[model samples]
Target chain A: MSIQISDPMLPELYKVTKIQENTHDTFTLEMVPKNKTKIFSFLPGQFNMIYLFGVGEVPISISGDPSSTDFLVHTIRAVGTVTDAMSKIKEGQTVGIRGPFGSHWPIEKAMGKDVLLIAGGIGLAPLRPVVYYILAHRSKYRKVVLLYGTRSPDDIIYEEEYQNWQENFDITVETTVDNTDSEWQGHVGIVSALISKKDFSPTNMVAIICGPEIMMHFSVQELVRREVTWNDIYISMERNMKCAIGFCGHCQYGAKFICKDGPVFCYSSIQETLKRREI
Target chain B: MKMLKTILENHPSFQELEREHLKFVIDNAENIEFKAEELLFKEGEKADKLYIIQSGKIAIELFTPSRGSITIQTLGLNEIVGWSLTPPYQRSFDARCVEDSQAISIDGKALRIRCEEDSKFGYELLKNFTYTVVQRLQRTRIQLLDIYKIRT
Candidate 1:
């Protein structure tokens, strides 16, 4: 179902169907529209402004498979007052959702080219939808390489999914942890370290990165070192988004409003702004 | 010797070294392989060799009272491991093979003597090792930040 934007600012009521704890601080919320028959449709990388009754709202990425129209999914970390409250919300509770906003990962543009997905920490939430899209239409793309990094082995989200993607699909999935105990046998290093593995060609590749700003910066540098062009590289930027539209200056980075102009942007367009110390 | 020289030439760490300097280092190096689960060196052991990984993975680990053995880092194909070239050299962590691995192990003592005999070769080796050290340090710093952890 396509998104029905009756009012950009007003949120529609949605009933929480399930909540799955991904880690100590991260959880996935599955919700469906309370009064509408149509499912909430959104492109990969777009976000929804999830609101609790008395508490405020926060922008969270749409993390579910786009083809699955049964419910909308969001993977969020309980990092602030609003998100902390949202974490305690029970299944069957009602919440407000306003969007499907911001730019999306260029899945269509990436057709016939190698797709590189690099995600760090909870940054993987925004890129999960893109992974689902690529898996559904696997034949449309060339080599698909996913390099994910987390704080530790326990912090890794979608652990079984990574194994499935690696074993079942014709994709290269390399997961690294910043630190790990002896029980963890996987690579232990920064996410950027995995780039040198060179499982996919840099030529004719579309790279999508979403992570802590510093992590993204270094990952971009490594990709560029491997000859991936700036135009072919995309990044999802996070900011304090109050309004899902350009009217609010809260999410502005340089002249671009992250909520409207991006969340997903070609790295070539904002490399300069990204380098700025404060914006 | 020719094969070892070729491997060193191809490795990014030693690729830019002067031909004679490369040859000098390779002279003190020999091909070695370790099976999966083999311990290459142990913590506090006399650090005698530096391994230039040709293929496969090796974990640099530290043993803690609580965790037993926690991996500090994993070095893979074309990477360098071990760097106790100074006096009173001792392995700071245990290096164990995570998979069947091949590398060129350079005798640290021989290489140190070679460095003293030839300052140019010493400078070259120092430069390359310094680069590796810096890179590892930067990666360690990033890991220390726990960037993936949710910060409220």
Candidate 2:
């Protein structure tokens, strides 16, 4: 069952090591190579093609810490057929993992600058690794702030880890829930509102945003108002990815491919493509 | 009500108020404290006062039929807790203390009257409240978008 990762097309078999419910509908999955001791590694913003037996594969971001070599982790919200089926699978099941693909977040370039991480809903799954990397090597960066927004209080992911990220890692984590629950006592507004309330200077600040396309679009606008240039802001784009190898036209956005050219890209690079309402 | 000039100057919204109008607000306002779980106001009540939180948190809530009480927002220090503008001024949501909290309560009636007497001050206050209203409106719009859902 231990398979090699040299062939980027054929997925190496991996067995689900752990599974946990992240929210009412989303789940976090951990997998390790079924036969091989070496599981493929990934960068913060990269993803893998998760294949469900007899079903299909979907491009899911690698949500685990890059520094930790133990197992590969992914957070999946059961929306479509494949993901819904994957969500129903129990631990100790076999699945296919075809990558650690795509360009990574600009973690290295962000060194010595203030880092602002903005996530919306399940979008946090992709950005969680960036936070982890920053926490692991906190000395490399300046102030790190995470502004996360969700639909309602119940939709938050990694609720238990937020406290530790704040207290131990010293990252500013501000969360907002649009709707209310008795247990939720936080800001009730868009993440942009929280950005206004913050004092992060746009100078020498790099912002990494991942969320709904619309939310990401607006977050960039707000940051621009705060003097963050489009060049310094990066966003993770999601599209219909089939090959993830750039050969397939399924993931094209203008000249770039969402799977190969990005999943992570600077705002300035794709501003034109992003503006097209229907595309 | 003796006021700290720094307090007024520190908040972005209050900072925009002319000094005299700022002083007028401080003079008309009274500091009050509420214990945890205490209700400051309720939905459908006449908008009598607006509270600017000095410290602690206030839960802006609504009574949901399915979920009972749902807190829509938590107002903290330097944040205003009540919105009362123009006619038919009525509280749309419940306000409760999340923790032992201190805030300054500005009488809505007195504020309206002051605004009427001083047209310039009235315009300034209205302008400030407009920002608040628009901000809340944008937030509401995002909430309606359910930006977090797996699919739109």
Candidate 3:
């Protein structure tokens, strides 16, 4: 056996068991830890760097819940070189993984308040872990709503789980597509259109959202219109990340490092950063 | 066809085309109508054709989990839409009609075939598409640069 250096922050190579396509360029990779007994834990928004030997590695948000250490999962979009390499790997192929890193969703604080979760396109992957965490501990919160939007109905991710969330009485879910097809029968418009129609008390609710930078900024404005405090809204961000440890400046968002300060952060905490497109 | 000639003749991108060439292409164009909130094309839909806005607006948007649908850009009259004619013939983003609109469109595949048959038309269309993509790319780069997002 070849001896490998051990890093507390890095999870050992795990074999990818499956890859599920979400959109034309996005996919979900399911991998079980090489040492399954060594539990890897993370907050809902935390991410990892899955190292594919020879082809290199890329930072990917963990889409799996912290509650279960059985298998680590990632929902990734093939945007560049490393991601393209990641998409090519198949079942039985071993890939290196590091970290359940970054600030997690504020689950403890969201308790007892109505939670509004909004996701756009592949942005749902990062929010998936938090949704599972909320549902797993259902009694801790009041009403819940998951409002999502994608390019089209076909671009919606997590089909089975989306249905399951819809079935639960405590949680409500709605989806919108930017463009509709012949078979599509749902609402067709910008995701922001749905906000005006939602009947939720912004005063007693915390909103969690992830997707593109522009989308989050606009969503914040909408929630503010509803009287939701900036502090009550949290948004996850995506940036080019080489080191999950934050030593590298690749994932910098203004003064905050997305890898260190958060992959998830309350709008109040990073309002300034969020405003700047550079972050 | 006459309406198309007038519209294409006025468009900023097509203004440089020789009048004869403009009229020739315009003669083959067709007008299409879209109802308010109707999808023009989805994210992954095959881009079999390209469109030129005659009247009204089209919104290009991207979905995010934290944010619902984020409107990226709104193209109004005289704008060209769709950019999948090259090697990677896939739609990159979603396009929808923000209002009931009228547009002139040409079958992209058919145009490509025509371009193959007639090199001059191919050169003209490619030049126009390149100009359109470059202009849009500049705007997108500025948006992604996050300069406006910064409060200070």
Q: Rank the candidates by TM-score, best first.
A: 1, 2, 3
Candidate 1 lDDT, A98-126, residue by residue in tens: 98898999999899999999999998999
Chain A TM-score (model 2): 0.96
- Per-residue CA lDDT of model 3 for A46-129, tens digit only, reads 888888888887778889776877788899877677888887878899998887677877788899989988887778888888
Flag regions of model 1 displaced more than 4 Å. Answer: A1-4, B1-5
The estimated TM-scores of all candidates read 0.94, 0.90, 0.63
Worst 10 residues of 3 chain B by lDDT: B143-152
Fnat per model, in the order shown: 0.81, 0.79, 0.00
DockQ of 3: 0.02
Tens-place lDDT per residue, model 1, B35-137, is 9899999989998888988788899999999878889898887788886577688888999999899988988888888788988878877888888888889
Clashes of 2: 2
The per-model lDDT (C-alpha) reads 0.88, 0.85, 0.75
TM-score of chain A of each: 0.97, 0.96, 0.93
The reply for model 2, stretches above 4 Å from the true place, is: A1-5, A35-39, B1-3, B17-19, B30-32, B64-67
lDDT comparing candidate 3 with the true structure: 0.75
In terms of lDDT, the best-performing candidate is 1
Tell me the lDDT of model 3 at A34. 80
- Winner by TM-score between candidate 2 and candidate 1: 1
